[model samples]
Structures are given as structure tokens and as C-alpha cells.
Target: MNPAREAMINGWKSPRKGDRGRERERDITAPRHDSSSRISKPARQQPPAKSTASNAVGKYLTQDQQSEQFVADEDKFVLKQAKKKADIRVREQRAKPIDYLAFSLRFIDTDRDVFDDHEGDVEVDIPAPETVLESLNHAQLQELHEDLTSYQTLESNARNKEFWSALLVLCADRRQKLKPQGPEGRALASVASDVDNILSPKSLEQLEALEKQIRTKLQSNEPIDTDYWEELLKSLLMYKAKAKLRKVCEAIKAAKVELLRLVDPEKAEELEESDGLPANSHNFAPSPAKPATRPVASSSDAQSSAAPPPGTARFSSTGNEDFSQATKALYDREVARGVGEGEEIFAAEEAVPSATKPLWADKYRPRKPRYFNRVQMGYEWNKYNQTHYDHDNPPPKVVQGYRFNIFYPDLIDKTKAPTFKIIREHGRRRGESFAPAGKEDTCLIRFVAGPPYEDIAFRIVDREWDYSAKKERGFKSSFDKGILQLHFQFKKIYYRK
Candidate 1:
């Protein structure tokens, strides 16, 4: 045995007992001491350093830049620690509601100017705002670049007046939102810059003139001429048919298309162009306060039409029947039976109904669309002020924000039946999150928007033993409580005038 070697290991003040005791003490005391205090107290964390952030599409760091950075080692470490120690007291400045409204108007005016394909022949091509150009490989980028250049050529060509007009309209739209100081509002500076270079003074003046005219036309009363009357009638009929048809189709589609948005089902909506513009969302604030002046209408005018009022729909007289059995029965008994003097009862019934029209299609036309959204600017409004809002409307609910604003696709006419889509909200929650209750359950919001948003707050419902189907989503209010302040894209909404 190597007695000297063993004796040396044992004798040379190993300090093993004290070291083990200290380690044990730390392991026992760690829970009692705030872990953050241990490191940060000694290092003396500095305040988090502020830096400029670009909203441009991609990250902008060369690999070598990290090495080139000339920051003091201790300062950098201190700043990093400080960021964790101190709560960031950032002053959030929200975009004006006008920014959103103007952007929306620009979207509408741009579409009308560029892509309102009455004949469906016009080639209006542009990538969506979210299109990640840098993410593409070189070949894809080259192809995209070529497509964009073609549009640029179209922008300059006087013959392609519509294309040019669209660009000018878009330019003006963005230009309105242009902040004289600070960052440009929702309007991209790059887009505004391009428009400036492309459009000359004469063209700019023409565009301004055209916008004035358009605005004037929008405000003017639409002539209720024969063509307008006939089309209005036609639209009413078609809308009612579609509305009645939608319920049945919706059930069928939901049963099948829960996992898919069908490309081409005759019953499914035709692939329409992007709703006026690319669906790019931005942070929004409430609309600017404006004094509203509404025109007073006679009670007679309001109730004169049998059709459902604008911004509303009247379901078929039959309640929840899968088919038009009552309508079919009436048709067969009254209108279907052609009349003469001997058939007095039937003839009299037919006369009262005015149901003797030759075609069966004419019999059950929509009860004269009373509520059509006539112009892009309509009389009807779905207001959300302190007065009208019912916070817990559509009960069994969870919306615990201080206040909320609603947004919609602008330029919807109340004379036509508008569709509903998903509506979003942004505000602080009572709790930290609404986790389990989101993306799975549907919240039937009673009073929401103008052309309302639906198929939102949506999640797959369970059919088994547990019948309860509600969702909790995103940052839950219960957990993420006061810290979770929500923000949404604002609107340029005014009270109905």
C-alpha cells in the first residue's frame, strides 16, 4: 500500500467538511433568497440601453457586425442585466384612427381605380403586403421583380389610365396619413416616395380633382331612376335568396369544411378579389371626435318598405324549417292553380297575393328589400359608445376590457345585404389570459359591427359527454392580467350621418 500517498491526501488540509457544509447551506437557502439579487446585486445592472428599431421586412445584421461592435465588456453585461431588473417604462404612441380610415379609403379608391373589373378582364397585379420577398430564393425574387417592373411600366403608360389612377389614389391615400414629423403614419414612406417620382404635377392635380369629384359624388343623393330601381329590386331579390340559401349551406359546409377552405364549391362564395386591399393589419386607435349631423327621416320612409331595414336581415317567415315547405304549399294551393270565374275563391286569393305571375320564380321574391345598403356611405350604423354597449351581451361570456372599438371594411352600402366576418378586440383583460377559451369555441357577439366579422373566436367543438364549448385564448387574463394591454388597428369611423 502506498501509505505516504494516502497520508498526503488526508493530511493536506482538504477543507472538504467546510466546503460540503457551505454547499449544503446554499442548496437549502436558495429558495429563501431571490435568485436575481445574488448576481445583479454584485454586478450593479445598468439601465437598459435604447436602440433604433427598423420596421423594414428583414433582420439587418452582417455576421461580422457582432465582432465589429466596440462596446465595453462590463457595460454590455451590465446593460443586459439591467434590462431584466428594471421594468421598461415605454410610452406607447398609437396611430391616429384617421390613419386607418385613410388607409381603408385608399384601399377602396385604389381598387375602384385599379381592379374594379366590371368585365373581369383588367389585369391588376400586386403582391400582398405580407409577401416576404427576401425569404424567396434568387429565381423567385427575379420573377417577382419582373412582375413588379411590369406594373411600374403600367403606372407610367398614359394608355393604362386606370392603373395610373389607382397608383395616384393609393399615393394620395398614403400621403394623407403622412406625418410632417416623426415616422410616416400607416402610409409607407417608400410607397409615397415612389408615387412622387412617378406622378408629375399635371397628373397629381388631375388626381386631386378626381378625388374631390368622387367625394362629392359619394355625398350626393343617388338617383332612384328606372335602371337603379330595377337593379335595386334585382339585388334585393338575389340577396334574400342568398340569405335564405346561406343557412342551409353553412350547416353543410361546416360539417365538411371544418378543416378546409374550399377552393371551388358552387355553394361556397366565388373567389373575390382581396377586400379592397391587401389584408395588412397595423396598430390602431379610436376614431377622432367629430360632431355628427344626421338627417331626420319621416317615420313613413323608415317603415314604407316591406324589405328588412338596411344593416339588418329578416329571416324567412318560417322558423328553423330546413326547407320552404310552407312556401311550397302556398304556391301549389294558390298561385299554381290558374284561375277563372268558376274558381272564385282561388281567383280572389290570387288577386290579393298578386301571385298570378307566369313564372314560379316571381312568386316568392324577397319581401321588397326594405333595408338595402344603398350607397358606399349608408344611413345605418352599428354604434359602440358608452350608451349602447352591453359588455356581457351574448352571455356565458368573457370580454373584460375597459372599452372596445369596432372596425369594418369601409364603403359598404346598406341598400345591399352585407356579409359578416370575424371581429377582433384589443384591450386589457381582467386576468392574465383567455387561454383555453380561444380558437376553439365561437362567441356569438350580439351587437358587433357594420358588415360584421364572424367565424372568429372559433374552435372545434367537442361532441361527446362534455357539451360545454367555449374558448380561452392568447394571453389569458387570469394569468397575464394587468400587464396585457391589447392594441388594434384603428378606424376613421364617424357616427352615421
Candidate 2:
């Protein structure tokens, strides 16, 4: 080999000055893991300490005798991979929840509260109850509510043992951490009671750990002792107590004297009274005691009370009257019930009652007049004297218009009613001065309306009277404030071109 060639090769392979400095620094600081560091600096070795769980927990050993107290490269690699798998879960979470601080580029979140995924649409901003018995820090109160809500929503099923156990732990934590004798405690206790419904003796399958324990004991050949029997008895008693406690807590949580009272005072009392009774009682708390009947005016009303007609069931024989919602709802329910009872009795009887002495409802039945009756439709229109007219013509004056249109909205299969607006000038006005033609009419007398009221009955009597009615009256009142001087009963509508 040539000396020059050998020198060139060595120059390329030799460490650079900067690399040599780094190598020297590493050598000086790097830890030593030789056999001397692991055992003692002796050739002979005694038998190693027996391997045990967690390095023989509770056994103290001097530092001089302890094995190399440092992690191995193989163990470090294993731990790194295990932690990577654990962090993958936190990184994939949509809510970004964390047991400890973490960060991830792929972390996803949502528009709603994290817990909303469990309980659909939680109602936020609910005003706190006024009867709080203990003062709690903001964090404590927040956590208290969250745990209560979680426990309340957790379903106890065979497949949800983990959820039930987690909920039980949360409940126990809240019960212990919160003021045990205060309002917050009572509120939490009520929420916790809901668990009894899910985890009572009837749903024992939800407690997998306890069930597994029992199974293991039953499978064991070892003799059972009195302590085991006592344990089982205690569990049975607890189940019974919880079963009864659930109903009481549910009632208190729903009653006006407790939960509902904070939300609504008017209905609180009514609901609280109902709470004491069984939930299945449909007729619980009889409809609040009925009030005394008013004096009846005529026999038209079929009311059985001492009060006459119009006392409750119907209006006086002649004039118009309306029943209030409360009054009508109660009266209708009672009447319907009574009618049903009468039918049952009649069906069971051997003979029918004569027409002269029919059931009370049939004997004094009230009649609801139709909106448009077929009578007095041919009343003679005397526009000359609006005030002087026969009683047969309900209105003394009416507005006449040929161009008016009536509209009906929401009709099936069409966007518009079977009607159209038409306008024609019968007489021209000079500079807004009216020039009455042979026939006088108005365009303002028309009205457009939505469904259920398109066919409003109207009569053409006098346009002047109709205009005056609009200015002087309300549609709901009486006082002869009629828009027309004459009214026609609904018989047949006419079409003219």
C-alpha cells in the first residue's frame, strides 16, 4: 500500500475536533450500568432476593444491598409503548376530557357541553333554589351538580355494570364531601335515591362485582362462617330499606313543598298534595271542591243543582252567553261522566223510560243556536229610514258593496279561497267630492280573513251605517252596533256577473 493513500483514508475516518469534544463530555457524565453497579464489586455472589410483587412490598432493605435502582433499557421501551397506548385514548376523545393534563393535534371538541352526550340537552341557567342551607364554593357547587346529574342519568342494566359502579363512586364521593345535613346534601340525597330504582334487589344483576363475589364464595369448598351469613343478611336489609326510600325521595323531589316550590308557586300546592298519593292513582285528589251554583234563569240549562238554567250548563233561553274555560271544562267533564253513568244504568235495566220523563240531561238539554239560521232572509230593505225597521231585520243599516272580496287561507289543494276581488267605478268623484250614482257602493266595506272564518255572514243594507259601525263598535260586543241595517239568514248564496 502507498503511504499517501493510507494517510488520505485515515484523515476521512478520524473524528472531527467538534465531535471529539462531545464524545468526551458524554463519557464523563453518562451513568454506569456495569455488573459492579448492579451487584457489589465482588466476584462471588449470594443467592438473589426472591422475586415478589412490587419488590416484596413492606420489606425494608438497606441502600447498599438494593439491586441497581434504575430502569433497564428494555423496561423503558415497554413503559413508553404502554403510555402511548393510554394517551391514544385521551387524544381521540371528542370532549377533550382529561384525568391529567394532555395535548394532542387531533383532539376534537363539540358545540354542546361534554355531559350533554350522556343526557340529551341539559337545561342550563336554571335559577338556583332559594332555600340553600349551605354555602359552597363555585367549584364545589359545580361539581356537586355534575355528579348529581350523572348519577341521576346512569342506567342500571346487566351490560352497564361499569357505569353503575362509576356512578355509585361519584354518589358516595358527593355524599361524603358535601354538607351531609344541609340543603345541598338533601338535594344530592334525593338525586342519589333515584339510583335505588335502578340498583334495588330487583336489579341485582347490575352489581357485577358483588354478584361475582357471591359466585366465587358459592364455588369455594371452604366452609362458610357466621360473618358470611351476617354479611348476606345485612345486604338484604339494605335492599329493602332502599326500595322504600326511593318512593319517599321521588315524592319529595316532585312536591311543591320541596322541588317544585322553587319553580312554581301557583301549581306547587296542587302538585304537592297529589305527590303523597300513589302515582297510578288517576283520580287522586278529587277535582277541587266545586263552587256553589248560581241562580238559574230558565229550564233550558240541564243543571241538576238547585240553581236554575244558566246557572252553569247553559245560557238563558233567549240571549247569547258563553261558558268560561274553567267552568266549561269542569261542567263538561261532569256532564260526560254523568251521561256515561246514565247509559250504563239504562243498558242494565229491563224497561226504558217514557219520552215525557227522559233522563235529566235529555229533559233539560241546552240548545246551541247555529251561527246562521234559515229564517227572515227575505227582509225588505228600507234604506230611506235606517232607524225605523221591524225587529225581524236584525240590523237597521248595512254597508253595500259589490266589489268586496272575502278570503280563506289554508284551504286544502289551493293557495287561495274560491273568491276574487273586483272593483268598478259606478260614479266618478270630482277632486275627491262624491257624486252619487243610481246605485251607491263602497270598496272599504270588504275584509280578507284566514281559515275557519272565511264565510262570515253579512248583509247589504246601507254603506253609511256600515262605516259608522266600524268607527263606533267592537266585534265582540252588543249595543246594536251593527254594520248593516238588515241581516239575512244563510240560505243560498247568489252569483252575479
Highest TM-score against the true fold, candidate:
2
lDDT of 1 at 178: 38
User: lDDT by residue for model 1 over 1-497, one digit each (tens)?
Assistant: 23334336655322255565454444331334344554544667797755556422236765565554534344444432322111110001111221222222222232233322222111112222212221233443344344334343433223233332333333332333332645533334445444444333333345455445545555568653443334333323333333322332333234323222343343222214223222332221121221010001111112211332232232111111111232223322322222222111100000111123323224322221111010011121236333454554422322221111112222123333222223222442222333484332222122211221211112111111112222422221110110112211112235764
Residue 146, candidate 2: C-alpha displacement in angstroms: 36
Candidate 2 residue lDDT tens string, 1-497: 43334436755233456766554454432443445445546677787777776475547655643543333344434433322332322221111111111111001211112321211111111111111102233343454456334423432222222322333343333345553468744654564555445446463334545556656776677788645444453343345333333433343335324433555565556655653422321111111121111111122233323332232122111222122233233322322322111111110111111212223334333222111111121333445333566576554332222211121212222443232122223453322324366443423122222222222222232332222334322122111211112221222223443
Against the true structure, what is each candidate's TM-score? 0.15, 0.16
Clashing pairs in 2: 296-308, 395-485, 396-485, 397-484, 397-485, 398-462, 398-484, 398-485
Candidate 1 yields a Cα-based lDDT of: 0.27
Model 2 per-residue lDDT at 73: 42
C-alpha RMSD between model 2 and the true structure: 30.1
What TM-score quantifies how close candidate 1 is to the native fold?
0.15
Looking at candidate 1, the ten consecutive residues that score lowest on lDDT are 290-299
